[model samples]
Target chain A: MKSILIAMLVAMTLPFGLATPACAGSGDVVVENAWSRASIGTSRPGAAYMDIRNAGDEDVTLTGLRTDLAGMPEFHLTSTNNQGVSSMSPVGEIAIAPGETVALAPGGMHAMLMQLRRPMEEGGTFPLTLLFSDGGEVTVEVPIRGIAARGPDD
Target chain B: MRRRSVLGYGAAAFGVIGMTLFAGWWRVDGPGAPQAVGARPLPLTEMEFSLTNHEDRTVGPETLIGSPTIAFFGFTYCPDVCPTTLADISDWLDALEGDAEKLNVVFITVDPERDTVEAMAEYVDYFHPAIRGWTGTERQIARAVEGFRATYEKVPTESGGYTMNHTASVFLFDAQGRFVSTIDYHEPREFAVPKIRRAMNDEEAEGA
Candidate 1:
């Protein structure tokens, strides 16, 4: 009976310990609907939007983002004035709670891909890496979409 | 002794006259009244076409030619740059005080897929009620953009999504539907306001 109780305790604690590393590892950051607009040969800028989900036990903050396709990647928010004029402002940090999701979408918050290195071809894939506040980073593949294509919700 | 006193008084008067002339010249030709740079002269490149306004009414290039029009190309879905630029134009108009009547601001939607006549009407009205919004079929919009040599493209994304990328320059046209000058996106206020005033003044001078 003593042996059986010890074996059961080990099994329970082993699973918890194994799960912790997996949760702490890279797969915890899930990006859905990541995409960028197509650009002409000019130095036109583009934007990318996606939903970021954190399925971990602790909170995480997105601190940095990068894409080789552009000169710089900036997180931004858009606000309208009383005259109904809209403007874009930089975002310093984006916090996500455990088991929650944060969305970067049009007409609100978005990621600006400034100074395109090359034309963003349609149906092509671009690489992006998002750095977290906890020193964790996740790299994802974003596919280019047409100019008039609507978002999933749109 | 009397001669010396008269000469001293004359010397003082000469000094005062010299100082007044110097001050007058400084006020007229100094940095304070420096010649304006980027002042676009009138009678820019002109083109004529008929298109539908936000009200779905037919508006021809003639409508743009009779007034000093501040034209911008953007889409309704543009959450930032479009609105910001439009707002800046509105602020400039307000700053003009009573001179707003001399200006006609027009927003041309580059995203024709979503910015319909009704949509443009609502979107442009949200800015300044006096501002005009213009949109037409994709072909018409393409023709208009091509005439201005503006560039735009649609890119595909994951999950069947896309975004419109286009040139960000603001085009200014005189009352003759002529292309006056192009303002860069990051133009400073000190430069922009003076350029606009010069354009308006040029129009008045031409009319006179």
Candidate 2:
């Protein structure tokens, strides 16, 4: 009965077009808008964007990502300098403070899905596991949007 | 009366010299000039480059000029900014109504080793139908970037694969090959469309 109630609470918290993977069951980290753009071709890498929130009293660190979608999945930050030149660099672990939400969106930090296994098509979905520093992981189904998708809601 | 005729002849000679100098200046930088008609020559437009378009045609600065053009530097492997900007460009063209056809939109690849003409063709197909893809040799791409004041650097990722860091801004040029302003990355559509229109108006604004 308690498990069923927790399921109900999870369903109530997540709305249509928003994805939150088992925060109630796994831990206090809630992920929403897990999505990626449709790749142009199989040779090119892809990227995923999402929002990870830490609802627990303690800080949570995102250590890594694992998925079958790409051979190498890493964290990348795309920064623009003052002269309007832009560049991307591999980022280290991301720490989410208590009640803080970390966003991986376009024009900023994102989950770099490198060396894609295949071309990610629009309307398709893939599973991704987010590894946390506490040895806990949450797997979310990432939906593929158009090549120009801004977010899950877009 | 003889002195009066001499003074008249001297005045006519001075007028002829002044006219010749004025005509030279006008032909060089005036409204009737054949190139960059009414405005200063845009350095980017003058920058020479020989590249192959997606359709396998030899294209240089002249092809891109003679019409309002927007050239964006990016690679097909780019997942976020390039696609987003292309989609934004498509939206701006849509907002342009029929006038969008009057403008030339080119997507130039900074990483030509991977982004071949075939790759560029398939890549630009995702966005507006009018977006033309251009790719060339590394030296050609370097030559092209020099004119726009654009820069690109290849950085190897930990995975041994490489990615490029390039200028994220879109360059805008008038029909006469005069440099206008640039549309920054992620510029709002409301602001972007107006800038495109401003470029479109350049020809008539200067009576060129």
Candidate 3:
């Protein structure tokens, strides 16, 4: 009876669009609007952007990420200097404060997916896993859009 | 009833917060500080430098000056900015309807070592058929870059590789080959398309 009540409570908090319970059982962090640009060729790397919102009271840190579509999926921060010279560097981890939202977008923060297994086609989807510092993981389905698309809404 | 009210309130809060965050993100990602078109034409009517086009043909200021030119400087290896800019320009030209043919779109390589004439030809074709890709000897490329006041340097990476750090602006020239304006690197179609139209209009008016 206790476990049944707990399960009911868990179901109440799990946000919408989270395809499965296996990916996000914590119900603390909500992922939405996950999308990436369609790849031009298989050799070139692709970028994915999304909004990660923390609904829980405690701070959450995204330590790493994984995806089957690419050989490596790593977090990166692109910095452009005053001279319009742009460079991208690896970022250790991203921390989201309670009730705060972190946006990974083009020309800013992005999840660089390198060595794509195949060309990312428009309207196709892939599975992604967000590993948190606390050992929890949230899986999401990212939709592929056109190269110029700014976000899922676009 | 109480649960519904709480959920509604939470959604409202999210709507307000999400909008604020989106606005902030757009400001940072969009073109930050683009140079506007100057009222007076630059003294150098034509930028002079000997370079080879994708067709292995010699090209200089005289060849590029017959039409209003749209030019950018970058390398083929550039993952984000270069491809994004080229794709944006292609979209802008497509939006121009038939007027796209009236302009000359050029891509000059900052890394001459890797971007050969044949490589340039292949790269520009991925974007548009009319887009011309240019590259030459290091000294020749330096002269062209200097003429435009653009800067490029080689940055060594930890993996025993290197990447070219270059100016990310698109330059516009009049039909007479005089410098007219510059669009910020990676400006969206909504922002860059109108500026291109304005340049074409000026070029037509000058011809009249």
The parts of candidate 1 lying over 4 Å away from their true place are: A1-154, B1-45
lDDT per residue, candidate 3, A20-91, as tens digits? 444342347767678887776676668888878776667788998999898878887766666666677778
The segments of candidate 3 whose C-alpha lies over 4 angstroms from its true place after superposition are A1-12, A15-27, A38-43, A116-124, A145-154, B1-46
Better DockQ candidate (1, 3): 3
Q: Mind giving the per-residue lDDT tens digits that candidate 2 earns over A23-47?
A: 4322776777688889876778898
DockQ score, prediction 1: 0.06
Displacement of residue B53 (Cα, Å) in model 2 is: 0.7
lDDT on C-alpha atoms for all candidate structures: 0.67, 0.82, 0.77
lDDT of 1 by residue, A28-92 (tens): 65677676655444344677778787755577889878989887777877554332233456688
Candidate 2 ranges beyond 4 A from true positions: A1-26, B1-41
Q: Go through the candidates in order and give the clash count of each.
A: 11, 0, 0
Q: Retained native contacts per candidate, as fractions?
A: 0.05, 0.63, 0.27
Please report how far candidate 3 places residue B182 from its true position, in Å: 1.1
Error of 3 at A31 (Å): 3.3
**Minimal lDDT window, size 10, model 1 chain A:** A78-87
Per-residue C-alpha lDDT of model 2 across residues B97-202, encoded as one tens digit per residue: 8999999999999999988899988888878888999999999999888777777899887888888888888889988888888888888899999999998899
Model 3 lDDT per residue over B54-80, tens place: 999998767866688888898876656
> Model 1 Cα displacement at B4 (Å)?
93
DockQ of each: 0.06, 0.27, 0.14
